[model samples]
Target: MDYERARAEQKLQLQELENIRLEAYKNSRLYKEKVTAVHDKNIKRREFQPGDLIFLYNSRMRLMPGKLRSRWDGLYRIERVEPYGVFHLSHPSSSELIKVNGIRLKLFHSEKMARNQELEIFLLEDPTTADD
Candidate 1:
């Protein structure tokens, strides 16, 4: 019967549509994972040593009314560098030590700049051309 044939065709079409949808979902998940891997690869690795000075990021600074205010606070010295992004910091004025995430801190390079200022500069003179 023609009705039976048409019903079989309709069932086949529905099955094909479901297969296509599943394939699409698989592709989307793969793409998302690839993007995440690339992002993690691009992140810079931070290393800290004991006695190094660093600035801590103040998460609450954004809530303040002043737009010009710096989000980074503290010139704390690194007392210890623990595994897995944990840093122990101590302030010169404070006796207590604080443990913070390494992601929230950046090394203060002011000491490097001071050492760079002592470098001697040489002025080079070009040889005079006789054709002039």
Candidate 2:
């Protein structure tokens, strides 16, 4: 019967469409994993300890009109480091302490540089000519 043949064709078409959908889903999952891997690879890990100095990133400035101003604000000391990248910071000039996410802060490299007492500079000299 023509009706039976048409029904068989429709079932085949449905199966084909499902196969395409499944392939697309697999591809999407693969793409997401690749993207996540790339993103995780580029992430920089930051660690802080008690008494360590750090600078806090000011994310609020992006909405404001200050383009030339520096976005980092601090010289805060890490009073404590909590689990999951949370830090307690205290400003040098203030007694109040605040809890902030570690991602918003970066170690103050000045502490390391200041410890080095020696400064080195290299100067390049030109060869003198015999006809001088």
Residue 33 of model 2: what lDDT? 100
Q: List CA RMSD, all candidates.
A: 11.2, 9.4
RMSD in angstroms, candidate 1?
A: 11.2
Residue-level error in angstroms, candidate 1, position 5: 1.3
Per-residue alpha-carbon lDDT of candidate 2 for residues 1-132, written as tens digits (9 for 90 to 100): 999999999999999999999999999999999999999999977767899888999998888774466688988999988899888999989999999998899888886688999968664455589997
- Model 1 alpha-carbon miss at residue 92, Å: 0.7
Stretches of model 2 off by over 4 angstroms after superposition = 115-132
For candidate 2, give the lDDT of residue 90. 96
Candidate 1: tens digits of C-alpha lDDT, residues 1-132: 999999999999999999999999999999999999999999887798999899999999878866556788879999988889899999999999999999999989977779786877664455589996
TM-score of 2: 0.79
- Estimated TM-score for each candidate: 0.76, 0.79
